[model samples]
Target: MRYTSEHKQATRQRIIEAAGRRFKQDGIDGSGVATLMKDAGLTNGAFYAHFASKDDLVANVVADQLREQRASFDSTPSGRAGVEEFVRRYLSVEHRDSPESGCPSAALLDEIVRCTQATKEAFTDGALGVIDEISAGLAPGDPQSVRAQVIAAFALMIGTLQLARALADQQLADQILEQGVQNTLALLPAEDRG
Candidate 1:
């Protein structure tokens, strides 16, 4: 029987959502299309019906993840509160350990750089949008300075999470998160900084 448009859309969404989780948790290359399909309770043969290739699904998943990240950041208040809240939530050991719910930038940075043009474009747009949001949270200042600050903050956030996850000891992980946050806050200007 032919499937309705709504059914097709829902099936496509399920595939994207499953791929997103798998991509974040197991890196793009770590999980195969068959495994992803099985995780979504679908068959590998049905995959092509929704996506032309795994790369296409990867791009879609990246876009979905970016939207989720944007929504999370947008919900937080701007200025110091927003920065503080972001750091607190993002740098925690839980965030470091839980790839499924954590930031996709850190999870897929390497794969993103190597992905197809469409995937790269999606990543670039998502990253720029994030930078713009972070910059807006800063006080009125030199445009260049705001841009630099946003870049620095983004680097710190992702780097700290990576480092925290790398360490063997829980205490070391906690230290990395705490010190990283303190150091990052110090980098901000006295008045407008978080």
Candidate 2:
């Protein structure tokens, strides 16, 4: 029987959501096509009906993740303490340990570095949008300078979280998160500056 458009769209969304989770949990390259299908509650053969290739799915997932990131960036308050809370939460041990449900930037950093142009473009665009959001939270300054500081904050947050997650020592990992939070908070504009 032919499926309805709504059914197809729902199924497609299921595949994208499942694939996004898997891609974040395991690097995109590490997640097999069959596993993605299974996770989406469909057989491997049905994959082609939705996505042309895993790369296509990756692009879709990256786009979706970017939308989510944008919402998060826009919703978060621009106050100094709000920025502190963001840094603390972002660099927390919970965020560090939960790649599957955590920040896509940190979760997919390695695979993204060598990804296709489509993937890179989508990622870059989303990231720049987020950087703009970050800039909004900073004290009023030259746009270029604010963007530069925002970029540094982002680099430190993702890099520190990645390293913290990679370490075998739990204490050191926790310490990394704490230090990362502190450092990230320091990157933000102070109340006096704000």
lDDT of 2: 0.82
> Clash number for every model?
0, 0
* lDDT of model 1, residue 125: 84
- Lowest-scoring 10 consecutive residues by lDDT in candidate 1? 136-145
Q: List the residue pairs that clash in candidate 2.
A: none
* TM-scores of all candidate predictions against the true structure: 0.89, 0.89
Error of 2 at 164 (Å): 0.1
lDDT of 2 by residue, 1-194 (tens): 99999999999999989998999998898999999999999999899999889888998888788778767765666656656767787888788878888788999978887888898988998888877766666654544556676789889999999999899999999998888888877776666234
Candidate 1 local Cα displacement, residue 107, angstroms: 1.2
Model 1 lDDT per residue over 1-194, tens place:
99999999999999888888889888999989999999899999999999999999988888888878877887887776786777788887788889887788888887888999999988878877777776667654443557777678788888888878778998988999999888777766545633
